[model samples]
Target: MMKFKFFLLQALLSSSLACAGVMGDKPETETPNRLFFAGLGGSYNSVKLDQYFNPLIGTTNIYNGGTLVAFGTANGPAVPFHTTQTTFAPEAQLGYLQSFSNQDWLWGIKLAYNYLSITMTDSDLVSPQLGTLTAVTGAGTGFTGRATISSIQTRIEHEFDLMGIIQHSFKNIHAYLGLGPTTFGTRTNIYNVTGFADIDGTHVDVSGTPVNFASTKWVWGGVVELGMTYFFNPTWFLDINYRYALSPHNKTNYTSAFAGTLANGYTKSGTLFGTTNQYITVQGLTFTINKVFDFV
Candidate 1:
């Protein structure tokens, strides 16, 4: 996906350069007022390292009250959920515009909806994994163990962006830029997680139960955009846009189950879980046919 986005960006640049060469030094186009525009485009998005993140379980303190080994916090190698995802997203936009000054500087705001989805599986193995648990007075002090982790974590991002727009025109062409805050109506699912611990120890379990890892409410981010439109007439145009958005997730939430057996045949089962975050950034290129209704 990285290679693909890079190539597509190169192509867009080439096309823009070619257009510039052909349209060389043409007189600037007339400015219009009271305009409404709508557009639809397709984009490709790929994600890399998170700005802020936590593994599924991050506690590793192995001693409880200075006596017992807290097995859950004994994690060594954390789960690798940093897998990359490539998404071909579809987006739609609506905006209203007018000339902001005699200089033909146009100012407006745009609202857009984008579908950015991701899904992946990750695993980790922690041997001699040990943690902090309440000491059962008579359970004996030598609590040591190993654990393995497996899970399928999914992220589906539905984004709505409201950006302020500014644009200037060249003969038969308009170049524009937009900036704004973005909101994510995202959903995450964590399923099929499993773990194994020491024979004489209890393992932490969260995968046995399916849970929603991310919520659909209140994930905020930001975006910057640059685009060009080639006017075929007064009301119709073909546009190509490049957008970059940064989404920083605050935290993750989920419920987990803990169940394991001791070498002495006693059964142990209870609770343990933690929060995490996967902040993602994406760059996209899109092409759309747009229509403008002008009131000049």
Candidate 2:
């Protein structure tokens, strides 16, 4: 889905750029037409994560047979409460831009490294049962398998972008657009994981737990950006732009971690994987000061 979205976005951006190229086209050329440019900027970003759980966990449609409470409505997978921390991070970008076909028209590539993440779903959660994974249990006879998950910290990513660029220069103002592939080092963390299964009259804590767990991986995605730069002189400029980035649609199969011990003689242990697609999208506005040096 994310890939499809990116392709669609690419198509739209291409169409718009093509039309603009034809409508206000000019034969623009300059001395020392090739340049290497570098800049520092800040990107304010928002990340959104979506994952709906499998109605039935594992092979069982019923957990505790409606006798005890689960995480959701009639014993769900997890709880409703969640938290999202937003960050405004700095980005470092360096790239080469040069005129192609015309002096006013240019094509180049920009490479950037930055970090961001999306805020989780809004307040009211239709399904609080999402992200419910645990180690299976042993030792004690089961009564009602219940769990209290203190928190599931969301995902964070270090994103690298390699964008193909196109621009049109008019007087002192230059408008540009870019679209290309991206890569990420992503991490997901879960904390305070504890569960219970009522045996007889006692609620025993399900052990072999992942009290604090984290997993990391590499992912691929895409980004589309549009911006304009104001030239202070021929070699210096100030740029402000908006960028929209989409991460790949990925899967979750727990942290592959089951630690700690069970208080009850019979232990509980197992892992949970959601039955939904999880992805991230980022929208940012960046401001930068840049300098371009004439090269070959």
Candidate 3:
């Protein structure tokens, strides 16, 4: 789904540019051209995370009758997790802008980087029988299996992209479209879990259970951008733009190595994977003052 959305947007951008190029309108290319440029800016970004957990050691579904809880509904146990966060971060871009000697079309190669932090939490009530793998207990055992669990996750990432952009100038302003491949270095920290559960007639407090240690992954994605730039003068200009990025789903398996103890002293671990195409789309508002060197 994410990949499809990204490609769809790309195709739209391409079609628009192709049609514009066919109009046979020639732009004035007599203004000073920028040969190289660099910029620093601030970005207000929104990060949304979608997480899925599956216990590879046992049955994946553990709710009664194998039905998981529905979101915002009084359905069953094993509530779903969803979170969104807004962050303020800094970004930097360095690139070379090229122009034909007698044309108003501009092309450039740019390298950019963004750094951001995200923190979120999810909590729910789980049936104690969930601890019993493949066997349903607590019936006639005088013990009701019930517990409350909450998880807090913190993550930080450095994202980089190398892109190619094409722009068409009109007087003092120009509109541009860019597409490129991006790479992300992400680090995630899992804190101790908080909850309680009943196991085989015994009640145990599930607190500070080591669910996960710190982990990191390097992943790849793609980005598409649309924006307009206005020049106050040949050497200085203001740029405003919006971008959408899509990353492939990242999959990781949790073993005993990065596990912590559960409520009943059982090892806490699960196989985690990104569902729904595991991607991030950032809506950013950027303000930049740039200085361009004229080779002429």
Among all candidates shown, the one with the greatest TM-score:
1
Residue 204 of model 2, lDDT score: 48
lDDT tens string, model 1, 170-247? Answer: 756879999999876655554433433333444434223332333455578899999888877768778788888777
The predictions' CA RMSDs to the true structure, in order, are: 12.1, 15.8, 16.3
TM-score each candidate: 0.70, 0.64, 0.63
* TM-score (C-alpha, index-matched) for candidate 3: 0.63
Highest lDDT model number: 1
lDDT of 3 at 148: 33
Candidate 1 clashes: the total is 6
What lDDT does the true structure give each of the candidates? 0.62, 0.61, 0.57
RMSD of 1: 12.1
**Which pairs clash (backbone N, Cα, C closer than 3 Å) in model 1?**
60-73, 70-131, 70-132, 70-133, 71-131, 74-130
Off by over 4 Å in 2: 1-32, 51-76, 79-86, 115-144, 155-157, 198-204, 208-210, 255-277
Worst 10 residues of 3 by lDDT: 68-77
Scored by Cα lDDT, where does model 2 land? 0.61
